[model samples]
Target: MPDNGDLRDVESTPLQDTGVRVFAVPPAEGAGPGEIMQGFLEALTSDDPEYDTARKYLTSEAASAWRPERSTTVLANGPSITTDCVPGGREETNSATCVLTGTQVATVDAQQAYRPAGGPYRRKLHLTKNPENGQWRIDGLPDGVVMGKSDFQRNYRSVDKYYYASGTAVGATGQPAAVADPVFVRSKVDPMTQMVRSLLKGPTAWLGTVVRSSFPAGTALQKGVSGLAPDDQNKVTVPLNLKASRVAARTCSEMATQVLFTLRNLAPTLESVELRGAGGDRLCELNEEHAESAAWLGSARSPEYLYFLDGKRRLVRMPMRSTGTGAVAVPGPFGDGGRQLQSAAVSRDERTAAGVGNGGRSLYVSSLASGGSLGDPVLTSAGASPADRLTTPSWDARGDLWVADRDPHRPRLFVLEEGASEPEPVAVPHLSGRIEDARVAGDGVRIALVVAKGGKRSLFLGRIRRGGGDGQETAVDGLRSAAPDLEQVSAVSWAGGSRLLVVGQEQGGVQQMRYVQIDGSALDGPAPGALPGVKAIAASEDERAPLVAYSEDGVVRLPSGTQWQKIDKEGTAPVYPG
Candidate 1:
């Protein structure tokens, strides 16, 4: 657990299984090779800042060469060790080799990026009798630390570092949308300082092309500075290298805003951040209020209303901030039922909407105001059946509309820039099968896709890359599985900055709803309780809002700490503004 600058003193207590802090016990005198290996592995999971106790079980040369921070290998379970003595070894010069084996689950690289991995894990530890005290000490081992999944969960925590979306025009908020790049860091090892360093290092490889950091190139913490903590006033001060010393005032404020947002996750009480130049001169200062003006955080902005298709196949909505409110028809041709709709999506600004009509063959964009007229279909699909036509439309913060055409004859994903120009086909490189559903994230840089192949549906996350010049194309690259374990995925929605609410079923199991991270990792909390006959799901980036679902019971919602309750039995295809 993190200590948030509380000055109160507490009584010293013995370490137990409380799961808050773990202290490593030094190896016992005259311990055998097996005991030494066990003690050393256990120490790697402890909260020791420098892993000094773990190094005690290694030879001097091994300790000098070991680099625990190089990487972390996560195994499905604790490693199984087998020891064997060297053959034909002299009695006075006995040597042994210990083999450690397990199943690899994931890995965290030196940059603190977590990637799902699968395969067998095997390593050899060479040990020899220490001539000084005749005790077993390991002389050769793997380069980095290894631990079980449970230990990794207990020792580290996931945090999102914010960055500005690259190459995106300013939205209604008059600023570039903020994108979240999540990474795992040691929980009790000065995480506040660790997160600041990560923020300065820029986004991960997959996200780097679509996001830009405010920090100048080569900017880093001043030499020898460590252990950053908030002051009594709930303010933190960050000192930077010379590279950031000559930045403009606006750039300096942007830099401070990034730090303020990143650190708030670990220390919510933090009120402000101050940036200083290499010469200790104040560069800029920013608070939560000011940070909001620097960049738009989609997750922090709540939707004004919840829109869905009513019983009459007309677009309707209810106030998002209110409960028990009756649904009302929206103020447009869609509300008048001039053209019956099958599905709908509201723009982020709540001023316009896009609906798929004519049994999913045509898509129309209209306003949410009264007397608004419906225009010709901006996009059309040639699928022979309704189930094989256009999917539900989705809007991004930039007001761009995204929808997938499931036409078996010409399956493609299309995007309407500002929801007006001719539909442009978006390339999906390396996609294995036809797309069943597509939802663009609020940041407009990441997209969640449901693809079906061989009668199985899986969830994938792809990065949206736009070409540099005109006449060029936009493509979704780096498609990776977001829910690889599920046998079938029915629906997916962005629930937060780096989280998604997923509806799927595991192999040999019933349907279920859960939250998953973009990196394919499970969230720490319990999933939403079971809801029967769920056809579609909707969630807001603002998690405080209820989770809306279109089920057999009609429109239903799941409030915080409560069971699902019926909202509108007549409503279907519920959605919140993107």
Candidate 2:
């Protein structure tokens, strides 16, 4: 047992926030082989300028060859080190090899994008002793570096590198369609540089076909400068290589948008961006207004209101951006019906609604405005009992409604396109379970599904491929685990273009919430604030929209705040327009 007094400190202290944290190096005086190895590992977490200090623990040849910026391997647990000395292997008659092993948590690419790498990590370091000073120094090792998760969090920050979505252009409604590619870069290093470099490199593997960058092929920073750094005036000057020098004036502004948006989260106080060529010639200057004007190129504006069902089973709305407002039922058939909804979703146009009945056996669709009359069930489940009926309904930007009929004997997932009379079945191969819930991404290209298998629930990301006769039919190409580490996934929602806010529990743990990339990598930052007794979860495509959920206390919304605030005394199936 632990002290109750000490537990308070742990409970009250929040997780590490986004900021620079400098890691210090201990004195190496009279350090043995083991001490030298530990010091070398710790030095990897130091800022770029302090990397010279890391070289101190390495031999001259090894120090010059090692490049910490090449890649970063993150471990789930602290590294275990074991050394073996060989008096006869080297001419110095004193050499040792230190083996480091741990379960790899993830790896940050040269572009700085973080991708899940769930497996074992093994590395070896060859060390030699300097007879004169009796100092043990690393003689040989791998090119990159590895560190534990805690240290990685302390040294790196997760930031979304923004890029225009496929086919998205200016004048688009809401936010520009942008897919967020979360990457990890050293907090103490030059994040602006990392972001710019990664943007030039383009989106990650899985998202490659879905998003495109503004930078031209072979575009890169100037040879001498590794990254862009802010000046005294909060102006960041980006020096591009010769490949980018031929860009036209209009294209330069678009290029500036990419850089500005990507660096916004990192340098929030940034005032302007200066584009330059290899020879120090100015290409363009984007002031604060220019950045602000183009910021929504690939993102969405915050939603106006959060919607859910009230105690009377009426659809209601809660103002998300303002305070001092009461929950008002939506005007129309949705609010007029005495119908009780177990789960529901609103279309992107905000004119239509799809809901699952209390027993989940009946699915209904109704117009959200007054003049429209309540209709009969739009779709029904084949389940014989309430527990085996339908899951929550979700709407995508294309006006397609998605839901899963949780019939264990005849489990199926369906999508109802606009103006369609009957829902169409989508094949989900390798689904060794029944579908619990499904949320389609705004682009209508991806779907997040929660499947229950062998008494355990799991979340999977599936790519939807539309092609069948008239191209109306859709099927999941394949299913990949997005929450492989969770014991059970109860709820999930698309938080952004390629990120999902998932509610699940780790092995042997209680329910918790966290943000994960579509590729399955966890987001970097404070664990998403949790809402106690939450039964369902919903989020808008706009990342800034408040997170809505149904809890024992009624309807709760987690705005850009640290705590969950109740909005309604009783509600369920809270959802935002897709």
Worst 10 residues of 2 by lDDT: 168-177
Summarize candidate 1's per-residue lDDT along 278-304 as a digit string, tens digits: 888888889988888888888778899
Q: Using TM-score as the measure, which candidate wins?
A: 1
Instruction: Compute the lDDT for candidate 2.
Output: 0.75
Candidate 2: pairs in clash: 175-299, 175-300, 176-298, 176-299
TM-score per candidate, chains pooled: 0.95, 0.80
Residue-wise lDDT of candidate 2 within 455-498, one digit each (tens)?
79998888666645676557775578888888788888888766
Q: Give the TM-score of candidate 1.
A: 0.95
Candidate 1 deviant stretches above 4 angstroms: 1-19, 84-90, 243-245
Stretch of 10 with least lDDT, candidate 1: 82-91
